[model samples]
Target: MKKIVTLLCLGILLVNCSNNDDEMDIENSTEIVVDETQEMGTDMYVGNFVSLAHPTSGVVSVSDDMSRLDFKNFKTDNGPKLLVYLTTDTDATEYVNLGDLKGIEGDYNYTIPDGTDIGKYKLVNIWCVDFSVSFGYAELKK
Candidate 1:
């Protein structure tokens, strides 16, 4: 009887499993919406890149929840490996590495680390790991 009950419970959980709709909704919101932003009280940290080693154009927006960092209209010359960062230093010497960038074109979001102190990180950098080069960077401000 114990074995049968255990199997039945596991089967029920598997049947109920579905795509996590809440997380999907946050990821899908790339463009900042006025009503949503007002309700959440999080104005997206918007910025644009200046030429460093590569020429790029785009807008990077971070949701006030810090759950999503979306890059829109983003373009950059291909490189070995690219990563995103929130940094206090322009050289990216002192920083928090967000995650591996999803792509160079189109819009995408990178998850911010839990308990990140957004106030300290004033710059966003797209860094090349293999070559230790900063392709471009943007400042985050109101």
Candidate 2:
């Protein structure tokens, strides 16, 4: 009887531990949003990434001088990837492998393809293996 009771207690402890681990994973994730219009100047708009909860949502407005890609609080993992979806009349889509962007804890800048159509786009989702486990949304304005 004592042995059986011990086994049952161990099982419960294991389950509780597993739950805690999952909570930690979520707590570590983050998301960031930046609004260029609110701030003056061009360079001021860059590197505005901030730490936030995992699985967050936000928007990014682009200006005439804004032709770069930037991100905030992006988690790093063994294999990170970024998927960009453009909402236009024809629905264009692109994918960028984020392997090089991993471990970048703060804001960073990236180059957008030249001649990207001027319109609003939604950042459908973002995912990483170790650093972040969340997704965000944004709109590009011209």
Which candidate number maximizes lDDT?
1
lDDT for predicted candidate 1 compared with the true structure: 0.75
lDDT of 1 by residue, 1-142 (tens): 4566567766755544555543444443333223545532465677887668888678777786777677777888878888889988668888899988778787777788888766788788888889888888888766
lDDT of each: 0.75, 0.41
Candidate 2: Cα lDDT at 121: 39
Each candidate structure's count of clashing pairs: 0, 1
Model 1 poorest 10 in a row by lDDT: 27-36
Give the number of colliding residue pairs in candidate 2.
1
Per-residue lDDT value at 73 in model 2? 46
TM-score of each: 0.67, 0.36
Expressed as tens digits, the lDDT of each residue in 1-142 for candidate 2 is 4566567777866766777454555454433334544443343222222222243333333334656665544442234453433333212334332224423244444555556554433332344434444333344433
Q: 138, model 2: CA deviation in Å?
A: 1.6
List residue ranges in candidate 1 displaced over 4 A: 1-42
Q: Note the residue pairs that clash in candidate 1.
A: none
